[model samples]
Target: MANAASGMAVHDDCKLKFLELKAKRNYRFILFKIEQQQIVIDKLGEPNESYDDFTSSFPADECRYAVFDFDFTTEENCQKSKIFFIAWSPDSSKVRMKMVYASSKDRFKRELDGISFELQATDPSEMSLDIVKGRVF
Candidate 1:
């Protein structure tokens, strides 16, 4: 449903798919995009997909929203995982696209209840594995 305040709506499938990822380990990541004024699922990553695969999914000049089920090892050797909500507004993307994605991010994020971390990335370097790991620890 569309949020009146942001003039954007997140499609129902987005939440359903996220639930599968969050609960069932059904996906590695989900790519989201704005189409027809609504947020929709653009792609799904396989459970075996690597972080590099997830990062490669974005275009160099577009804005997107994504959720990645990140698995990591703690310093103590514990296996841990976190769900990351990423707002990707690449520097080369259009100004309007960036604004709309930024404005709609909160509204859209509200639909997915279990996100563990949120990252707003303008450059690919900002969300790199090293940076993400540093933030998590």
Candidate 2:
């Protein structure tokens, strides 16, 4: 499906992996990158992975997209899980790459269908676990 605004198509496998993460709890996160004008899966993190593993997958000077399954305990001590859509455009990434990722993010995210939170980050601090927990609680 080519997005009219960005002219980028999201590969079918991306949605499949997202569904697996959302419904089956089969993955900790999914990393995506744009290649040949299409968004494709770059990696799939194991179900028991840590946040550090997810953060480490992103390149220092590139733009990417990801979905993370965040599990946390609420103030009442109730366990909850939320899926977050993250747009990763690091500060050192090329300006053109950043622009392209920004422009296509919405269209790409729309394809995933069940994200509970959306985060746009240019720096690691912006999308830290603390920030995610803050958003949840």
TM-score of each: 0.95, 0.97
Model 1, poorest ten-residue lDDT window?
1-10
Best by TM-score: 2
- The TM-score between candidate 1 and the true structure equals 0.95
Model 1 clashing-pair count: 0
- Candidate 1 lDDT over residue span 85-108, tens digit each: 999999899999998998899989
Instruction: List model 2 lDDT by residue over 13-129, tens digit each.
Output: 999989999999999999999999999999999999999999998898999999999998888999989999999999899998888888999888888888999988888888898
Candidate 2: regions farther than 4 A off: none
Give candidate 2's total backbone clashes.
Answer: 0
